[model samples]
Target: MSEKARMTTHKLFLLPDYEKEGEYLTKMHSVGWKLERVSGFSQHFVKCESENVVYKLDYAANNTNYPEYIKMFADYGWEHCGRVMGFDYFRRNADGLSEEEMEIFSDPQSKLDMMKRVILTRMTPLLIIFFMGILPNMYMIVVNSMNWDRSTLLFLAVLYLGVFALYVSIFIYCIRGFRKLKKKYTE
Candidate 1:
């Protein structure tokens, strides 16, 4: 028998919504790549015949009972594919399943709760770093620019400004995603 083709891809950064990330993996599965493992930003997939597979992601960074947590999903038909960066990846055949049946979250409130968990666990630290570290350093760099060469000052300023821009973009993206979810479900 021929060996299955395998490949690796870098996700680069976490998506604002886990559903979007899951949808991306589901799309890949529909095109014949089955997710096998995940390591940091790298996802490994093995080629297979194209089929309808539903992929779902759940963030459970602070889960104390990890096995029980996974067992709960497995009891409901979700096959745990992998976990990376506190995100658990699961998949199952989507044939003859309704959209709600394919979903891992039971209700709109659960989805909102998951988003809150993500915000607390991931975004909070990012906000802290942006406000406490990057902003302060940028201020210091500006106040002490005279001590450094012109080229060095320019490089530091540009670097910090780029990071600042990135942080702002991410914050906006996440807020919009959360608001959309809340409005779509609550309305």
Candidate 2:
């Protein structure tokens, strides 16, 4: 498949804070649309053409009117996939909330999970270099010491140091990038 066709943009719509579920149903029905309630949070998947749009209904603070909207969509025969309490990390909302709020609403556990994955990825290469390159070089150095080759020892030392520096540089870059991303999202 073409890249463009494979790439689909999923837009999130946040229902108004005080709007009743029925009101949203009325609006959607008017546009020849309907919402299908999934499970938790009164979420619905809106269908248009061949695409199913996912909606997450949150009334956390001042918007606790979801049943009405659910009824409205039910009346119109719109099918919904399922409901979920929260969205995955990749979902994007097209509401007025700022970037900071978006970051805050994002699941902290998911962020930490991603961080762990990144750290593991960064460590894998360093561990491989240490075991395969550095350890073997160290063994060679020990073996060579018995031969009393001063120049060979110096070269091995320099090579080991070079490998160590390269490993340190890579680790530093990964750590700094991870920190920057964490600061940007958390702050």
Candidate 3:
């Protein structure tokens, strides 16, 4: 067979969605195979033939500059392969796995784990804002109350609100940026 026909290495670039990773692994397990997690750059690996298939998990890229990364990969001779859906339905259909195997792979535990990780990642910034901004504002309020100056208190309150609004706007903008990135990559 030609080299392309005999190609055994399959590189999977995983978007930073941990839930999706867990789901992919759970489905793969149903087929009597398991994925090994890797660090940095690539996230997982699967032994295919003479080489190990490298799977990169980057849930961060799901909503980041993934398109540019994909382009860079293409430039480096990596083919634009198919993507795995949240579950293994597409894989099962393509690989012709039996229904029994699919059921086994559809493990709830993996899905739950994936969900937890995704939620944690998404919430991290919000948690940071709450601690850094809201908590400080609370402290300021306490301090202002002790001083008992109405005008100073009002000014401080207004200033804090303005800062809070700015912080919220920035957060929203970042979220939009991620969504845009996702759209670009999917296209």
RMSD of every candidate to native, in Å, equals 1.8, 15.0, 15.1
Candidate 3: where are CA atoms >4 Å away? 1-130, 139-147
What tens digits encode model 3's per-residue C-alpha lDDT throughout 39-105?
3334343533232222223222153565775565556433333344322111222244444433321
lDDT of 3: 0.46
Estimate candidate 1's alpha-carbon lDDT, on a 0 to 1 scale.
0.87
lDDT-wise, the better of 1 and 3 is 1
| TM-score versus the correct structure, for each prediction | 0.90, 0.37, 0.31
lDDT per residue for candidate 1 within 76-101, as digits (tens), equals 89999998778889999999998887
Candidate 2 per-residue C-alpha lDDT over 13-69 given as tens digits, one digit per residue, 9 for 90 to 100: 222211233334434434434444433344444543332222323322222565664
Stretches > 4 Å off in candidate 1: none
Q: Deviation in angstroms for 50 in model 3? A: 48
lDDT values for all models: 0.87, 0.46, 0.46
Give Cα distance to truth, residue 122, candidate 1, Å.
0.9
Query: Which model is ahead, 1 or 2, in terms of TM-score?
Result: 1
Instruction: Name the lDDT of candidate 2.
Output: 0.46
